[model samples]
Target: MSMKNRHVLGEAVRHLILIILALYTLAPLLFLFVNAFKSNNEIIASPVALPEHWTLQYIKTAMEAINFGKALGLTFIITFFSILLLVIVSSFAAWAMVRSKTILSNIVFLCFTAAMLVPFQSLMYPLLSVFEKMGLKNVQGLILMYGGFGLSMSVFLYHGFIKSVPASLEEAAVLDGANLFQMFFKVVFPLLKGTTVTVIVLNGMWIWNDYLLPFLVIGNKTGSKTLTLELYFAKLTSGQYGNPWELIFPAVFVTIIPIIILYIFLQKYIVAGVSEGAVKM
Candidate 1:
């Protein structure tokens, strides 16, 4: 076939495939949104039809059941500080590995690489024992644990980014009598805003939506259930009698809202950051 004809055929096939996939993905979300408001009878009678009476009762019940505000607040507390520690500590660690020129630096970077492959499940018992000994089976302990786990990946990302960052900025800062602290915080650190955003977006979602780790570590102590764990329990409890749409749907939406908002604002950086890492690997 002619080049033009082949290209036209390929374009037509791509469009057809994309349209089918879009429907496959979007139809379920549309179903969930519409069905969350529908009566059980409505869902049973006509799965695709619009809800006869849209309801906030499910949302209200869900929020109340999970204590949405508290879950959100707790999630923010853990994710914010965890990401902060991950960014600051990991960026500098990565920079030193790249620029400092030492066997120790190489060893440290290698250790981080190894650490990244250590699955969370394998470390659970040891972590639980340490927390138990230290009496940190609470939200704070969870945050600390997340920071440790997140550091390896965060450092890996920072390593990629700092490779491309010019070193002269740090050297010039040194010429200007800037100390290590000043050169890092004021100069090199500012340049890492993209990678930092990337880390924040990735780790923010991971820590925020996590359930198993928090549940295993903290075990639903009244004052400190993170959002996902709470949402899980809410869904479990709400399962009887048509799932109490008043609560279940709202919980589902609440669990997802922050991530959606974060992604909306930072999608460009996220895409570039993800693609950069993928291409490097």
Candidate 2:
């Protein structure tokens, strides 16, 4: 074949591969969305086909059953506060470690880096016991736990990105009469906007969709449950005999909508922040 024809054929093959991967990734989500409008019988009978009669009945029922509004509000509060705490604490720690460049700082940074490899399951029971004894096994406690668990990765990212940032800017701010907080917040933190958004997007999705932490901390109680917890109990109360596909599909569909919308809007930042952070490191 001619070189031009070979190039064209290569492009065609790449496009075909991309299309297949896209469809593969999207297929399950598409199935869930379609089944949200379907009855259990309809879903079981024809899982792949479009619903014979699309209806909002299942969606409404799922919402009412799960106390969707309250759960959504609670989830938003937890995720927002958790991300805020992670960004503030992690950024401060990362910045200090990077600037200090001391033996102790290096050790601490290594500790944080090592922490990312430790599985939560290994510490889960002990953490719960400690928090329970401290009377922190509630919404407030959940937020704190999220901050602690999310800290290592956040610090790692911020550390890399902060290395890329010139220390002269902070020194200039200090020389101009800005205090510690002002120098860090105004001069340093603002420059970290990209990484901050990336941190929020990454941790927000995890916190929003997480079931285990909330289940262990909050116990699936009606009054103080996150969306994921609500969905769990919703399934349990739905029926004893078998899976409740109708309720399950719609509940999961609604629960994920917020995070999906968030990812859609902030999707661009994930790659940019990760690349910029890793650039210096």
Candidate 3:
């Protein structure tokens, strides 16, 4: 084939592959959305078929059953505060460690790096034991747990990105009579906008969608349930012997909408932050 023709054919093939991948990734989401509008029998009868009659009946039922407003509020509070704590603590630690440039700092940074590899499963029981002993099986404790579990990766990201940042900017701020807190917060933190958003989006989604951590900390608690836990109990109370696909689908769809909106808005920052952070490391 002519060179131009060959290039055109390759481009066509790449586009075809991408289209297929896109459909594959979106298929489950599409299914979930469709099923949310369907009755249990309809879903069971034709899982892949379009709902014969689209309705908001199931969605409204789910919202009421799951106590959607309260669960959503609790979930938002936990996710928001957890990400806030993670950003503040991790960024400060990363900045101090990077600037210290001491042997001890190096050791600490390496420890954080190694922590990213440690399986949460191994630490889960020990952490629960410690928290229980301290009477921390509550929202505050859950936020603290998120900060700890999320710390390693957030620090790792900030560390890399901070190294790429020119130290002269901070030095100039110091010379301009900026104190330690002012310099770090006003100057350093502002520049980390992309990374901060990236960290928030990454960890925020996890905390919002997470069932395991919340379940462990506050299992089936009446007033403190996150969205995931609400969905779980909603499903449990929905049926005794069989799965409640109708409620499950609608509840899940409702729960995920916030995170999906978040991702849509901040996705560009995620890519930019990861790329910028990776530039130096």
Q: Note each model's CA RMSD in angstroms.
A: 2.4, 1.5, 1.5
Candidate 3 global Cα RMSD: 1.5
Least accurate stretch of 10 residues (summed lDDT) in model 3? 234-243
Q: What is the C-alpha local distance difference test score of each model? A: 0.81, 0.93, 0.92
Tens digit of per-residue lDDT, candidate 3, span 1-281: 99999999999999999999999999999999999899999999999999999899889889887899999999999999999999999999999999999999999999999999999999999999999999999999999999999999999999999997788999999999999999999999999999999999999999999999999999977789999998888888997413588889998999999999999999999998887776767
Worst 10 residues of 1 by lDDT: 240-249
Tens-digit lDDT string for candidate 2 (136-220): 9999999999999999999999999999889899889988999999999999999998899899999999999999999999995
Query: Model 3: runs farther than 4 Å from truth?
Result: 240-243
Tally clashes: model 3: 0
> Can you rank all candidates by lDDT, best first?
2, 3, 1
Candidate 2 displacement at residue 129 in angstroms? 0.8
In angstroms, the error of model 1 at 143 is 0.5
TM-score of each: 0.89, 0.97, 0.97
Residue 234, candidate 1: alpha-carbon lDDT? 74
